[model samples]
Target: MNSLKIVSLVFFVRSMEQIPCPCCGERLNVIGSRRRKYLTSQSLPQVVVIRRLRCCRCGRIHHELPDFLVPYKRYAGEAIEPVVANELPLSVAVDESTITRWRQWFAERAEHFAGCLESIRIRFGYGFVGGPSDLSLSVLQRIWHYVGDAPAWLARVVRTVANTNQWVHTRSAFCPSWQGYTIML
Candidate 1:
């Protein structure tokens, strides 16, 4: 029974080595792997499989593929950070639904990333200093959209800050009660 289990495991692992390293032309070592599910604009579900590889000789880590996301995808914790914050489209073919799906996927994986960051913060004992309290509504929208799935307290803080910022900006535009406020973020 144990031998059969071992054989299956070996077969499964061997299958992951089918993709060769671009630089070395050798079977890359599997460092890690993950699968992300995304919903299309039509509400169709699709899965993206990501595999991380390392070149044994050069000690360089990279993804092995037909270049899924352009150059290459690094499976770092902060990989999606820029995507969430940046307004520019990473790919010309990428649509609004695609971006939204990517954000949802990132949110789903945020807990793991947050835990890793927390560990580093604890080890280094670093602190965040106060910055300018004032922020634009657009900036707040980005923040709220990105960290929407964070802890309840954090979400509340983002909402409060964004609301205050919006209130201050539109105070003179119209009556406070007549001001239109929509929470897109």
Candidate 2:
């Protein structure tokens, strides 16, 4: 599960009570942590320490992710936003194939993301007023209407979908690796 900004790992380690297991609704206990390599907004590689939490009831483990990181992607959301919006990045930090892959990944899920946001707005009655038709709106624009244009909008989307249990995982549910945990909330 992802938090907006991890001001302190100590905060998470001490505040597990505030976090519930996404799978079982049980409290999560810190088991350990793992180091992951992530690209910063400037496309520089950095190592981040992610804490792993385990559900006492289900014995499943989840990684606590920061807002800047997108699950299963190495680049920060800052670096990805421009590319997804079709804006040319100031510098090429990755190969062309990776950029293409990012676009494809987003395109594959854009409609689903929009649908989920729409459903949330309707179900929760978030005072949504009529705007442009969906056909005339980009995915980002649709999201803006629902959640406003927060800088951490992508992270907001990830958290919202995960919390609502509407996330579309790329991995097969039947896979062994997919059995235990989900996106941390």
Candidate 3:
């Protein structure tokens, strides 16, 4: 019953208060923090220390990951956005290997991710309003149009969808807890 929530980017840079459980909607207790090596626009891996919280009611462990870092993705969404946009990231030159993996990852769930954006567009009315809502474009495009290239845009989108119960975060991006093709990471 663990779930993910989007705390501010400041959460990663500094200490923060407790978050509510995405599952039970109860207050989460700050248990501890974990350090993960994150990918930046640079080729180097930057270490980001993230906080961990546990739901008092469900006892599910929730990791407070920055919105920039998608679960299972080595690079932050910032690093991936430009590549997804058909442009290179301004700061760092990530190798094709990482880009290839990103493409493969997107290709694997293109429809599902697009569906997530479609649902969000219908509800939020802020992104991707063209050429039918049947996911003819890449999911990344649809998301970008709606949320823009803001630093934590992906997490904001995910938060909105999760609020509607169309998605759930169980740590892994490929977690079995997600209900359908409409789910987002």
Candidate 4:
């Protein structure tokens, strides 16, 4: 996630060689590309072509997923924000069961997410902004004050968490306050 560049499909397609592989710490070679169908909040679903790259050293394949696209999920995280914030999402692309899983996942990780965000604010010399604390807010709304009205607000929020700590993808917080347990969300 740290090495990922939030670039256009055209830019990624044209410059796949410049990107490094997340798996093996090797320069990536363009192996091929594939089209994926994803949904937005309104209108028919859109299809975008994403490039597939191989690690020149480890020979592992990696899909160059866009920041907007949630890995292994059909609907963008942005598309699901409304549903997470309020009522159920009425869409054919996503199912209630999937949304249930998302809610449960968020509930499980909300505290960790909040503490990380608070750390980010502290690191930047900005203490808490007098908004909803992690315990008082839903995971989706935890950082609303920080995110503000930015376009693609979901992406920016996620980018903040992703940029804050690279190991969040596969490891649990290594704080003494946290009981030693692996978090693989």
Top candidate (lDDT): 2
Off by over 4 Å in 2: 1-17, 89-92, 128-135, 171-185
TM accuracy, model 1: 0.26
Models 1 onward score TM values of 0.26, 0.72, 0.63, 0.54
Cα lDDT tens digits for candidate 3, 110-181:
455557766767667765556676357556766666667666666666555554445533536554554565
The residue-level lDDT of candidate 4 at 74 comes to 72
Give the alpha-carbon lDDT of every model: 0.42, 0.74, 0.65, 0.62
Q: Considering only N, C-alpha and C atoms within 3 Å, which residue pairs clash in candidate 3?
A: 127-146
Clashes of 1: 0
CA error at residue 113 for candidate 3, angstroms: 2.9
Give the count of colliding residue pairs in each prediction.
0, 1, 1, 0
Residue pairs whose backbone atoms clash in candidate 1: none
Which is the winner by lDDT between candidate 1 and candidate 4?
A: 4
Top-scoring candidate (TM-score):
2
Worst 10 residues of 2 by lDDT: 8-17
- Per TM-score, what order, best first? 2, 3, 4, 1
**lDDT of each residue in 64-102, candidate 2, tens digit only:** 777667888889887776677676534557778988998
